[model samples]
Target: MAPQLTSLYTTSFLIALFVTLLVAACLRAINILPGRTCHSAKAPRKAAPATRILIVLGSGGHTHEMFHLLRDLDTSRYTQRTYIVSGGDAFSAQRAVEFEQTLEDRASETRNKATTVRRRGTERPLCVGAEHFNIATIPRARKIHQSLLTTPFTSLVTLVSAFSPLFRSDRLHPNLPPTTPYEIAAQDLPDLIITNGPATGVIVVLAALIAKFFNLKGCSSRSKCRTIYVESFARVKTLSLSAKLLAGVVDRFLVQWEELEGEGGYVGGHAEYWGILV
Candidate 1:
């Protein structure tokens, strides 16, 4: 009878602890998640001298669409670009390099065409160089034809690996202090994170959430790592799995179709439609 009572008490204590942890997680999520209304129009409280942007690229279609969405990206404003791709995804890495080359070429052409000496503050210089961008590879959350029963283990691995790129690594400049703008950007949290519906995208965003929840590197306090998720143009009626999962968490959830707007019953309200971006 004593043993039975001890078991019961132990079970009750575990249950109580579980409930406490669940409540704490919920409160933290609420505090960090973005609100329903879009705040992109508002000016930032304090702008950094150099801005860094992290872009997550997926395989095939997702990668194709992401570049299209960023076709008009102003390299001058986003001074540094970090491209994150899953391991063994050479195509995406190559694409990122090609994109940077294009930016560099465009900058060169603009400089050649300029007839007058540019005055200070009139226009920012183009951030076009190999020094301004980097490509990082992380393990895939799940491989093709992988068993679902073991997925949680692999996803956890992916989540843990995702945080490395989010934080500034000292390995970037091991021997010397960062002096240039590009070097400084490399050692700071990204100002923005952009992704489309990819398996790895969800994991990266979840990692960002965890960092913000703990205020890792002052992510939340500095208002850095703001995320934007764009739904695929093909999803006309319903949200994609990644879109649904991220609707409440990302700073902006944009759908190409009008039908998908207001679809997700998120605590932050509804998804937004800004026409077909891709």
Candidate 2:
């Protein structure tokens, strides 16, 4: 009789587990259906639009190094670029503009030289890439050893600002077309988000990841909002606080040094030691 009772209990537990799993699966399917449907209908786009790229700048060396990286990028490919800088960072904004101008000037020089060499007006048009990059600012989330009492409030505000640009697109891009009712749904989330370690980056990245999770605006692909986190060149042996925190969410965690590879304690994917990016 005891053995029979045990058998009955096991059978009941299995049934309950199966029901729970079935319900959960159904709910998941319902939630994912909308994104999947839209993705399928729009996928295999005949001609993919230019990728919208966002680069988060953390003042000082972060800005300088990234400037070189951006300058070298193929502007024709990444047509829409957004630069996120922490508030009160006038230098970064200025630098971004300068970077743009530098490319333009160089392009002109190259074009003229080509024209001169060709002995006619057969030179190709300028290939200025930096002009595509746009800049926006967010307040810093924390200071080194910031007081715990006030950290939460600042962090909260910073996080909001990271997502705040959604409501006001014109303010960022004055030339943008008139927004429509579907503006909110069809908003352009960055196709690619790239950043290096800085306390401020943590918030911006976190916001992007959350938006991706919900299949919200600006995510080009329903299944992913590609984020790449490059460890600071300064840290050759260890990951910084921001890098470590962002390891799980970033689609790619790039290490500048060979030794630091696989140190993130995350199996999200193999950490690539791409050597120096700057």
Q: What's the lDDT of the predicted structure labeled candidate 1?
A: 0.86
Candidate 1 per-residue lDDT, tens place, 1-278, comes to 35766665687789998999999988987888886555665476644557999999999899999999998888888888889999999999999999899889988888887756665665777888867888989999999999999999999999998888889633455788899877888888898999998999999999999889999999999888999999989898878889989888888888999888777746634688889997
Q: What is the lDDT of residue 146 in candidate 2?
A: 85
User: For residues 149-256, could you state the per-residue lDDT of candidate 2 as single tens digits?
Assistant: 999999999999988643232233346753532232224666667788777777877787667545575342454346778887888877788888877656677788
The model with the greatest TM-score is: 1
Q: Worst 10-residue stretch by lDDT in candidate 2? A: 31-40
TM-score of predicted structure 1: 0.88
Per-residue lDDT, model 1, residue 93, is 96
Per model, state how many residue pairs clash: 0, 2
- Please give each candidate's TM-score: 0.88, 0.70
